[model samples]
Structure formats: structure tokens, C-alpha cells
Target: MFGPFRLTSPLSGGLLWKIPWRMSRPQKARQRARLRHVDKVVSIVDQALAKKGTTTAAVERWKAEMPVEQEMLPRDKYTIFDRKEKKYRKGIHKLPKWTRVSQRLNPPGY
Candidate 1:
């Protein structure tokens, strides 16, 4: 029953490749908003440092200005538990106290 069967060639056109899709407009906008907030915080910190002329005061002010709800957390909330040493130690210090003392001794270091 293969009478009058005709062979057809495959269609040729532009390449067809799968591409990864991207976020919708609303999702993109929300992401941009979050980035903007981060940028604002950075700018605020930078401006405070520049205007205060002293890192310690700027940091103290920043801490004082933080929301009270954040302050409710235990002082050692971020402290690391030294299992071997059996003590709670501060995690990486953002601005160690020694740095301030050293800067006082050598203002140029600041």
C-alpha cells in the first residue's frame, strides 16, 4: 500500500534554541526597590561617617538611631559559642575597640 508515496525534506529556517526566561515587571520592580533601600542605607552610613569626622561617634549615633525593636535582642545574640573554650565570644567585630584606641594614639591611622 506504499503507492505514490512522496518524500519531503525538513524545513530550514533560523536557529531554534531554548532561552532562560526572566522575571516579570512586578518582580523586577520589587528587586530594584530592595537594591535602592540597600543603596540608601550605604549612602546614609557614608554621609554620617564623613560629616561626623570620627568613626566611633558615627557608629555610636548609628546604634542609637536604630529601631528600639532591634535593641530588644540580647546583647550576645550574635555572639558565637566557643564549645572548646566553653565561653561566648563576640563574632567578627565590625569595629573593634582596639582600632579606636590605636587611632587615638596615631591620628594619622584614622
Candidate 2:
């Protein structure tokens, strides 16, 4: 966008700034939604960390705070529906809390 025509003689040169492109309404809305979701997660994590006290706490404390490592067993087959995917998830509650697992960590109720 910055071409030779953008340039001017010293007499005509004061400032030649480029105007930034703005997002469309839909794009802006989507970005705002994503930001809100991220902010919500950050706030929850901050609160959890604060409530958990020191970084080096007891094993029991860590166990009480962290999410379980096992797959969640839903009470019913159709506990939740994913709107974005446009599909019905059966036994959705039977999903795991943590994507990764270790021998030590497990879900709270598990």
C-alpha cells in the first residue's frame, strides 16, 4: 500500500501515516467472544492458585485442587450437547477431566 505516490517533496511532507484495517462486525464479535472465554479461564485459574496457598503445598492439598485424571462418567447418555459441532454427544459426562494422565493424579470424586 505504501507506494512512491505516498512520498512527497519536503514542502509537502509532514506526516504520511498508514491507516490500519479494521475488523468486520462479525470478526470483531468473534474475537470479543474468544477474549471473554480466555479472560474467564484466566480469572478462574488465578482464583484457584490464590485459594490453594503456597506453590509448594502438601500432596493432599494438590490432590484436592487439581482436576481428576480419570474419564468422567456422565449420569445419563446425553448429558451435554455441543452446539458448534452440530452433534449430540452421548455419555458426555464419561469424558476425562485432564487430557493427559499420570499414575498419581486422579479426579476429585474418583
Q: For this target, which candidate reaches the highest TM-score against the unseen true structure?
A: 1
Best by lDDT: 2
Candidate 1 local lDDT, residue 56: 64
lDDT of 2 by residue, 1-110 (tens): 36766645533667543422233466435534443454466456656777987333444454464333222232221233334333343223223441122223222332
lDDT of 1: 0.38
Error of 1 at 2 (Å): 56
What TM-score should be assigned to candidate 2? 0.30
**What ranges in model 2 sit over 4 Å off?**
1-20, 55-110
Q: Which ten residues in a row are the worst by lDDT in model 2?
A: 98-107
